[model samples]
Every structure is written in C-alpha cells, then in structure tokens.
Target: MSLRSYLVNLKQALSSRTFKTPYRIVTGNQSADMDSVVSAITFAYLTYSLKTPNEYIIPLIDIPREDFALRRDINKLLSYHNITEDLLYFVEDFDKFLDKSTSIDLSLVDHNGLQGVEINKGFDGGQVNVEAIIDHHADEGHFENANPRIIRTCGSNSTLVFHYFHDLAAGQEEFWESNKDVIELSLGPLLIDTSNMTQKVEDPDIKAFEFYKKVLASDTVNFTAQSNYNDFYKTLKTAKKDISGFSFADILRKDYKQFKFLHDDRVGFSSISKPLSWIANKFSIQDIKDDLSRTLKANQIELLVITASFTQKDTGIYTREFCYYYEGQNEKYAELYQLVWQQLELSTDLYRSEAISSLTNGVNDSGSHLKIYNQKKVTATRKQVVPIVKEVLEK
Candidate 1:
C-alpha cells in the first residue's frame, strides 16, 4: 500500500478503534516541533520490517488534535503533501486510550525518553514494551534493552529518519521515485531545523543532505540548492511565526512544556515566534498577567518562562527575548527568581519599562512576578535553557 493511503487508513482505524493490539506506536517529543512530527511520520512509515503480524506500526503526533492547528508550519508542510489532519492520530488519542492498553510497544523518536507520558500496564497480564529508539538528542540513557537503539547528535532527527529510509532502500533502485512525497516530507524538517543548512549540520553529503538538496533542486533550476532550501525553510518559518490569528493561550500551548525541578518546583515554559514588544502592544499588562495567572493555575505551575524570537525587520538580525514570571508566590518564589538571575547566561540586559519594572521589583502586584531580558544569545534553545534552569532550581 502507498504510504499516503496507509496514513488515511491508519487515522480511520484509530478513530474507530478497529486495529488489533500489540501496537508499536512511534512518538516524537512532547514539544511537537517540526523535527519531532516529521521524524515520527517518516520513521514509522519506513520501519514496516519491524512490525510483526497483527502489530500496528503507528506514527503519533505528540500534540492534541485541537492544538494541531496552532502548529502552522507543520500544517503547511503536511498540507503540501495532501496529508490532512484527519489522516493522522494525535498524542491525545494515545494518552486517553492506547496508553493503558494491554498489548503495546513504543519507539522513541526525536527525544529519547517519555517526558509527559505515563505508560499504564493494562491488566496484570498485559504486555507493554519500549521496543526501539532512533533519536538525535543527548541520551537520557533509557530503554537499555530496546534493540537498534541508535542515538547520535545531528541538526535534526528527521535527518536521522532519512538515514533510516536510505539504509532500508539501499538496494532498491526505484525506491526514491516511488516514495517521492514521503521523501520530500522528511526533508522539510531537516531544512528548517538546520536553518536551510546554515547552522548546526556537517558533512552534508554523508548526511544525505547533499542528495536531498539535489532532489529539491530538481524541482526547479531557477535557484541554487541553498537558495531553494532557504526559500522552503523560510516558508515554514513564516507560517509558524504568523500568530495573528491565535489567542494568547493558544500561542503558549503551541510550543509549551512543563518542567519539574528537585525542589518540587513546577515551572511552565513557552517559546513563541513573535517579538515580545509586539505582544506587549497587542495586549494590556493586566490581560497578560491574567492569562499567565490562569495558565499557572490550570497547570499547577510555580512560574512561567515566556520567550519570544523573531527577525529584526529593518536590521535583518535574529532576535530573542526571555522573560521570567510567576503568579502569587512572592516569599518562597523569590529564591527561585534569584537563582535563575544568577545562573542565567543569556547575556541580556533587562528591557526596562515602568510596567515591566513593577513586576520585576514586586512593586505593583503581589499576584505576579516578571523580568524581561533582551537575550543576546540568539540560538540558546529550550534544550540548552532547560538544563541550566534545572540545575540551579535543584540547588
């Protein structure tokens, strides 16, 4: 069966619970970024050999169906391949239903460990397994028993996914042409995640990036591979950064993750793709605080670390803004704030404003605390920030 048809059928069967047990669910990280989403789809589709009889090899997007729309870049890429949201299963489905099912197997992708998911071994005799892992993150050293546990540092996990596909189709002469759409879908994340091959990737040829570049270049000779790839990357990045249609809450949830430190400090963090100044202009401080307060209350978090990233329009420089905030824990949370300030290495000066200072100094509202930074280090992603914050929070 064609991969496209298989995805459609998989989604349908998932909705009706028509599939058999012993599901080998391939899942991405909870962040549900492009790399995670594409890797899950591409990896699960290519690993049919790993499937035994009656065991379903399923690709699960680690986000809710409702929240899927918030991932504009992912939607755009999938839409380009004519893969509708109806043709996919989400983590919400896995969480609510399949997680507790008896016959289940899991393969970790993009990320190596279960972040927010708790696997429930349904019934005493039920079988639950962590079967395989193919990732590009720093190993959290998990699933020691899973065969073919391949982990390596790379610009994108989709790059690793392409390697898997390339290895499987090594001797098959017509494989690339037959699975053209899937090949392109897998490459989209690699291009975007690597910033059009401008950062964090090496040995383009060995990585299949060179071959992927040729595949994309064959699309048209009007541009060089770098230019063609850059255009594609920008298209996805633009769609992701276009947050005009979404509410503040949806924006937060789009790329949000919850963190728990040693002090039992539950913190919430979100990285939005728009400028902080733009956000401030669009909503009042009260509205911002109210939404933040509500989010903390709903998630039971002690604080929210909101970050904003964008390209400077006139200057053409990429910019990142970081903020530290908490709702209603002044006495105890003061220690939390101090530790972060001392350990934080973004090298950013505070973007001082009257309203910002109020929250930063704990003057205006006891209900919230806020400190905004210019964040000079443009590439310090959540992967880097998490460990730094986690280390200090523990101390």
Candidate 2:
C-alpha cells in the first residue's frame, strides 16, 4: 500500500477513541536536515488534523553551533507563512532544558516523553529525543521504548517523512493536492543531503526523479526546488578533486622518493593544510564515514586521517576539514595528509571514530570497497599554472 494509506490506518488505530489534552509533539534538533523536518511536520499535521484544534504542540529542538545557512532557509520559509519562533523551541542544551521541566511525573507527560523520561536523564547528545527518535541510521537506538517506530536507512530521512505526509494528505480528498507542497519542501534538503547524486543510496536516481516531478508541481514559491541552489553549486565546485589535468601516480612516484610510511595501525590519523576543498563541497562527511563503515566491516580502519586545512577566502582565511580512512597497511595516508596540513599551517578540524562496521565490509560490484577515497593530486603543472594565472589575471 502507499505510505499515505498506512498513516491513515495507523492514526485510525491509535485514536479510534479518545478525549484528551493536545499532543505535544517534539522533534529533535534544528540542525536536522530536511528529512527530519519533514518527518516532524508530517506528524504534526496528522495528529492535529485527526484530532481537535488543540491536539498538538510541535516543538523543534535547536542545536548549537548551528548551520547559519540552513537556519536562514528555515526562518525564511517560516516567515513566509507568518509562523513565529514561539512555535519553535530553541533548546541549545537539551539536558538543561529537560531538567528545567517542572513536571517530573512520567504518568503526567504524554506518551512520547515517557520513554523520554529515562532517556533524558542519561542522554548524551548525538541525535536528540532518545524518547522520540525517528532516524534510520544503522544501530540507532532511538525510540526503543516507543511503539510503531519508523526508522529506515533510506537515502534521506526527509524522504520517509515525505511519504508519511503524502499518505496522510491523500486520505483527505481536499488535502491530496496540497500534499505535493510537503514533498517539495522536502526535496531541497534531500538534494543537499545526496549532493546531487554524487553520494547515492538505494534507488536514489529513481527517488530524485519522482520528487522532481512533484516539486515542479508545487506552486508554492518558497517551497520551490531551487531553495538551496547556490549552496549546491558551491558544494559541487568544491567537491571536485581537480585530478583531471594531472597524473597523481606519476607525481607521487617522483615526489615520494624520499617519503616514508610512519605508523601502520589498522588506522592512522592526520590533518592537511588547505583542507581537501572538494571533500566538504559535494559530500557530507557522514557519507564518507558511512561508506568507510561498510568497507572496513570492523568500522575501525587500519588507517584514518581527520585532516584540517586553511583556505584563503574573502574572510581573510578559514579552516576546511574532513576525515580520510583506509584499510590494509597504508600508514602514509596519515603522514602525508598531516604533512600537507602542517605545511600550510592553517587551522584544522579534527575527526575521530572507532566503528568496526566500516573496516571489514566487502567490496562492491566494482571490485572496490563500497566506498573509495580518491586522493590523487591535480597535475603538478597546475601549481606552475597558478603563478601564470595570477600574473595574467592580476596584470
């Protein structure tokens, strides 16, 4: 059955009979991608529509060190609809916020927060709402206490949430057409999360096309498909490793004549100077981490480098960074990346993990690991061409 039908059936089954206070629905973290947002919104719509007007309080948890761009995007959309911040609960520290809750009685709070009661006291943050988890990350222990939990490791959590909304809206003949807007609202982040198909998941190409058609049908201007267009272009440009113009193997052969492999743990860590400009541009670091988990099987690689580097941007300079992990005994990955980072002497971002699921995962159909890290430097001539470009352009 379509996802919409399932939601209708689920809602019907849950609230077949009830006269109670409104449902206080809580979504974890504002830094959450579109999938999470869409999921929360779908739940709000379903519970509110099915019950009375006062039946739901949808509060969005805010994460600190927020992504300013994403925040602006969400604020703009909320403003377009005249929605205020009061509707959003900006809790920077979930622990402190939950601790401030006057009501301590589990029997008093709603069903979702009951499981939340124990989770809140002992929760160390990653994804929020241990009591109300709705993610599909493998091994995510979210909402174990909550029933009918929805967690599918699809390309994006938004996709799952979109399905939920589509299911709910389709049931109401008057709302079927508007459901398309929810799908469109979700498409922007899904595109962001997938990096325009560079980092893909199962059936990704099919999902993108289907969502594209639905987004085009969404007449809601704010929810247009191009919401994050500029960021997408920037990310794509940065993601390209620029290896097309040069032979890395040849360069490495000549330059590495004096180089040495330092440490050879199943993993080694290092940082770089200019940062791999492209790594952050087109791919979420999480995708890299996930791929590593699949390839290494042990989640712990033989070698890993969380490289950070400095870049010359308009704001004087800034640090860009990402993690690189490898298997077997190539310890050079750590030393080389670290040397690159130090040579540049810029700021660095640090990455660390010890998940074994990544190290022992088998190879894909291509005979490579499910994930591959391409570290070829662009042609040596490109470095020479830089001075020429500077001379010509500046002159």
Candidate 3:
C-alpha cells in the first residue's frame, strides 16, 4: 500500500480506542537515516496540527558523522520552520529508556522485516508494539500484526513519504512551503541510504536514468552543504580506520610462528594482524574496495582477501562493494554476480561471520582466490579495539 493509504488507516486506528494513549516514536540510531526521522516528524506534525495531546518522541540510536548529510536536511526544515533539539532525541542505549510509555513504532519504508527484526531484537524480543511500518524494502511478507504495514519496493522510502505529504498538502501553498523542509530532510537520507545500499530495480539501467532525473530536478539548495558530506564520511572513516596499522604477513610470523596451508586449493587465507584488525574495524567496505583495487593492481593479484573488524552492533552489514576479475571470461563475473542472491539467503549474523571467517580463518585453494571478505572477531583482548561500523552498501 502507498504511504498515503497507510497513513489514513493509521489515523483511523489511532482514533480507535486501541492506540488512544500518548506514545513515543523510536527510530534507527544511525545518522543519515532520515527516512524514519522524517516519518516520525510527519506524524508529529499531524498531531500538532490537529491539536492532539499526543507527545511525539523520536529517538536516535547511533552517533551520526560530523557532517551528516541528513542533519542539514533537518536543519533546512528547522530553518524554514521552528524545530528544536527537543523534537529529536539521540540515544546510545535503548534499554535505559524504553517502555509502553515509550511507544516504539517504526517507519521503515520497505517490503521486508529485516530491519524491524534487527531493531526489535535489540530490545530483547519484546513486542515493540510497532503500530505501523512504512518502507520500500522488498516485501518479504514478514512483520506480523503491525497495525498498518505499508511495504512497497519502490525507488526509495522518501518517494513513499513524498507521495503521502504531497497528498496531504493538496494545493496548500503555505503548507507546501513548510513541507518542503521535511522533504529536503527526507531526501538526503533517502539518497545516501539508497546509494549506500546499491539498490537496483528490475530495469536498473532505466531506473537509474529516471532516478538521476528526479535527483537533478530536485532543489539542490534544499540539500545539505557539500561540507556536510564530511560528517558522514568522517563517521564512516572513524568506523574503519585502523585496519592498515599492521601487515598480515608480520602477524603470521609473530603469532602463528609458521604459516601452513590448511588447503590452499584456490583461495589463500591470512590471519589479520592484531594491530591491523584493530585498525581495519575502522574502515568500511568502500574503503576496503578502494584499497583492494589499488593493492590488486599494484601486486597484480587477481584475487585478494581483506579482513576488517567491526563491533558486535554492526556485525552483519557489509560496508564495501568489491569488483572481481574472473580469469575465464567476462561472463564468469556475471555468473559470480548471481552468487549474491544465494549469499543473501544467509542470515545477517551467519553471513557476516562466515564471510569474515573465510577471510581470517584459513585458505583452501590458491588457484581460485575467492577474495573472501571477512570481519575480524573481537574478544576480550580486542575490547580496546574501538567499534567502527561503516554503513553497509545497501545494494
């Protein structure tokens, strides 16, 4: 269903005796995650305009970068209108403040319950009472019993929000003007999130053309300053900066004493140096991809493995996109591309762990160099290692 219809149904349900009490809205903790925040704000706008006493609370779960593109969005909205820090709350710990009084609802604009499940799991399996969910992730038919689950696998979550606000604005110039701030705020996160996700549609080439068209048509002035890009990048950098501190070769010599081929079939494995692993946790997939590309070109290595570490919080998400050159034919890479679908079958934890293990554990074959991408496992000795979770490439 469209966000519009979902909002209508949600309004009806809210009017019902079921959700008449005051409630708080919980959203993703990460910055540049304007989708949830915008949705929550829109709902708050509705309550405020209607003179409802319902208090709207939007909580953030993570630390956004210094130049988070999305914050500029909220700043734009706040600039045009009157919004204060009071309207939005950031929290590193959810358990400290969450209860029925803290009505935690989600505005995930998609078709899947992956995020919903992930977020809810953080709350220890307690039913979050997610009254409604508005998202565009591929519809996996998950999220049971949500009041109004509007999951459409469209271009972006902002697209869904745009249609909702557009319909609600309905030719009101003043309202439209004010709403533009929300749209601007919503757009930054949407664009960045989609970009990071590597989201592609069936007709991806065509869709990309259309998507860029829409982006170009959008008011560039509404976007955050290019300077704002640094904050997100800084946060990303902070997440995975230490991986380069030590050479994997040196660590093997010191710790393992002797490197033995577990299999050496086609892929070779190298234990990430403790210092390097400590550092690698600060880099993301993109950083790894860029570095790998350079190293591969320099050493003329057809395939290489890079092991980085992230915190328990960001265990499953992939931070980089890699390009592999198959030996046989160009079509071989195409066939390898299809492995992503099979890869997606693995649960988030399994996927992240196995991928990291494959890289850090041991190599079986050297001829086929699988280019395993693994995250270093952090334990008591690695506690000093900071948590550097880069934004996963959403695609």
- Most lDDT-accurate candidate: 1
State the C-alpha lDDT per candidate: 0.70, 0.38, 0.38
For model 1 the TM-score comes to 0.86
The segments of candidate 3 whose C-alpha lies over 4 angstroms from its true place after superposition are: 1-22, 29-59, 62-87, 91-93, 99-127, 144-147, 169-173, 190-395
Candidate 3: how large is its RMSD?
Answer: 15.4
* CA RMSD, predictions in order: 3.7, 17.3, 15.4
TM-score (C-alpha, index-matched) for candidate 3: 0.42
* Higher-TM-score candidate of 1 and 2: 1
Q: Residues 116-172, candidate 3, lDDT per residue (tens digit)?
A: 223545445653555555665444455667645666655455555455544554665
Candidate ranking (TM-score, best to worst): 1, 2, 3
Ranking by lDDT: 1, 2, 3
TM-score of each: 0.86, 0.44, 0.42
